[model samples]
Target: MQTSTGNKPFSCEVCGSAFSQNSSLKRHMQIHTGEKPYSCEICVSTFSQKAHLKSHMRTHTQEKLYSCEMCGSSFSDNSSLKRHIRTHTGEKSYSCEICGAAFSQTVNLKSHVRTHTGEKPYACEMCASAFSEYSTLKSHMRTHTGDKPYSCEFCGSTFALNVTLKLHLRTHTGEKPYTCEVCALSFSHIFSLKSHMRTHTGEKPYSCKICQSTFSLNCNLKTHMFTHSGEKPYSCEVCGLSFSRKSAVKRHMFTHTGDKPFSCKVCGSAFSLNRNLKSHIRTHTGEKPYSCEVCSTSFSENSSLKRHIRTHTGEKPYSCDICGSTFSQTAHLKSHIQTHSRIGIKC
Candidate 1:
């Protein structure tokens, strides 16, 4: 035969693909013609070749004839087993023509090419949102359907995506897999690691369209949007007060419960918030992280440094409505208001 003799004489005029026999060339021409003669009876799935349909039938039969020698992983088809073997072999034969990025699978390379071509074939019917990958579009559909397929084994929490469930599991396991190279600090989630990195780089990618105020994290930018919109979603059940943040609502609950969860070991003092405990610890340690550039003076808290900066700028924001008098500090404004009350002033 011509195949054994290293000859492919039958060539197609369309793509110039040579074949060993006329029958082989005729089968190869079906690719250019967009023809799939073979079809599965069960699913009605069509294939260009008979071997592919034979492999598709195995899925209906639940048959795995081919298996990996390295990991004992099974596949319905031999080509799938070969692709699975590439994971062990670390063979990335497929490369992106534009970026030269390599992938072990042809499917991954095709997805990568879409990044260069700006091709988003997969689209959601609910929101008209598009994605390059079908898997991503499938995940986006969960937002509309309210379907959480992935559930945490440790806790009873459910997530729409498997990756979110994996991140939630780390909270119980106390696993800090992602680490910062700059500070040697660790985080459970990759997003937390990325946000922590922005603190060092001072990179604020998220910007508010209204005020043009930028934030390092997207969550912070979303929270900042509430300031512009005057939207406070989180409400306190105890006092019926609303807050822009859930953490503020949590801190408000401690005021009602009188629960000082954060405790200072040095002075045996307690605080409702963790940040308050951190600030209290700095008093004992004499660690003034916030410094004034004008007078070279330092303070334990950033709020104290901000108040000190107003002294240099002479910026008195707090003003009395009755007297039209302004004070540099709130304590001074309160003292001034007491004078008005002592003099039988209605204000």
Candidate 2:
């Protein structure tokens, strides 16, 4: 009756949130103090309120009290059941003010707002890392703990996160839900689709602070950062040679195995890398896609075009360590180094 009459006499001292009962006010105070008195014996999960602990206990008991009539899905709580029903109705009441992105849950809307505000409330205790979402922080903790709780039923493969396990399951199912509107190409992951979209849009959002070099993918930008840091994390087991990127390490392994998997359909020529095969194909088709801006000269390869541009710009990027002599190309630098070797000088 007090809740309906807008009479909440018991007010919180910290947040000024009013409650009808004094017991409810005491539970609400735990939020400000970061206190969780109630804990689950099964999972060691803590909750501020006893009702929350009771709700969590249903997970261990497998006692679902609420059921969705639309899909017959059962939930431990009525709030969870209501959230699940939104999936069928496609109803999103909560919305972001900045981007106008809608979410069914208020918690999701709060999480989305962090993207605009750049707020990271949940911080890692082990490492110097922070996350906007508490769930993301929990996932980050697994990296330090080396925990792989989520496992695949098909392949028996383990993953640190449930979303990663879902992505892995798509490999076995061959389910490509994310589709491109421009090319009709499909991807299993949303991130893969977003990266593929850059190919059509010509967008290079990821940029290196050191060289100002831009990349379409964050992974490519991370690999570019290795050049600045001189960090080679990926190492080949056969040759013991290190590379900045994992793909580069894989390509290096092919040299040791003498495995040329990528073969040209035109001339029966084989290459270790698919990009090399694509460049080799241009030679047969007489396709010179790379063009010079100044002389209008065309080249089959981008590297060749870059070298050609150096001729016009008088830019000698490759420099000799011994004599400090600069050359337009690596081949020119190698030829210059040979001169030093012939003259009894070590380079």
Candidate 3:
């Protein structure tokens, strides 16, 4: 089907693909030939199309001409500015018919559609784990390779992607735009605000197939499954120590590096993570919010509440990586290793 008259009508002889202009047809031919005529001056990168090469040049230039009216922040392109404008407008034009959920962008709508359709088209060749989108599959592949391309300009903190780098930039900027309607609790990112809203709505969308237990997010559901499956995917190459979560592995790296960033404001005691500092704060405040529903027994920390619940459920989820031994707590499993291990044994 042809539209109105155009200058040059170029039709593909092989695939029947037609283009309005001859130049577009010539550019399209490079895809089949695998030819990259455009090359980057700064790096060894090459592109088949000239437009992609122009966009790549913006990275070297650091030139963001497009500015936001609301936030006064600049972007490299017009599309990025348009996406930033949606944050101010709160206008979700693209919506899902199945769930009646709306999103700002068409790409995000397509990703959300996979949740309803259960269509995971992209799969990992090594593990056969599926992903809804090609970009997510690319990020998942980086886990296998341990590739961190995005690095901070200030402290040299490395990230897997540009979005993660942007989120990390917020810690330096102190810009929290996403605010809650209920509590007025602000977050640096819109995704963080959406996750915080789940606490108010009591919405647990992600559920386990085995126990039917629910979670607020897909990542939480993934972490919860590790308890049942005993899957420790992230492992230390130095000592062969395994962990269920990636963040746990990152914190454990502090032991090797001797890095303790978290410090108490009340006292001079230092800790590895913010959660440890939070648990330490309970000693001063004497606050025990997590209480047992059955016996009304209170605990200083939520981990204690979880351990106490295991007494009722008889769930010893944590298992040894070396042997087949299981225990309720990870600390207990660590202590149990001494029975089988010789003196001066690492990990």
TM-score for each predicted model, relative to the true structure: 0.76, 0.58, 0.42
Regions of candidate 1 where Cα sits further than 4 Å from its true position: 1-41, 46-48, 208-212, 286-347
Higher-lDDT candidate among 2 and 3?
2
Give the per-residue lDDT of model 1 (tens digit) for 23-95: 9887888899989999999989999999889999999999999988878999999999999999999999999
RMSD of each: 4.5, 8.2, 13.7
Quote the positional error of residue 337 for candidate 2 in Å: 13
lDDT of 3 by residue, 1-347 (tens): 34344644676665667888778888888888899999998897999998888777888899888899888999887778898899999989999999899999998999999999999999999889999999989998988999999999978999998899999999998999899999999999998999999999999999999999999998999999999999999998667799999998988888887888999888878898889988998888898989999888999999899999888888999987777778998889988787668654444
| Candidate 2 per-residue lDDT over residues 210-323, each given as its tens digit | 889999998889988988899999999987888998988888888898999999998899999999999999989999999999999999999999999998999999999998
Model 2 is weakest, by summed lDDT over 10 consecutive residues, at 1-10
Worst 10 residues of 3 by lDDT: 1-10
Would you list the rank order by TM-score, best first? 1, 2, 3
Question: What is the descending lDDT order?
Answer: 2, 1, 3
Best by TM-score: 1
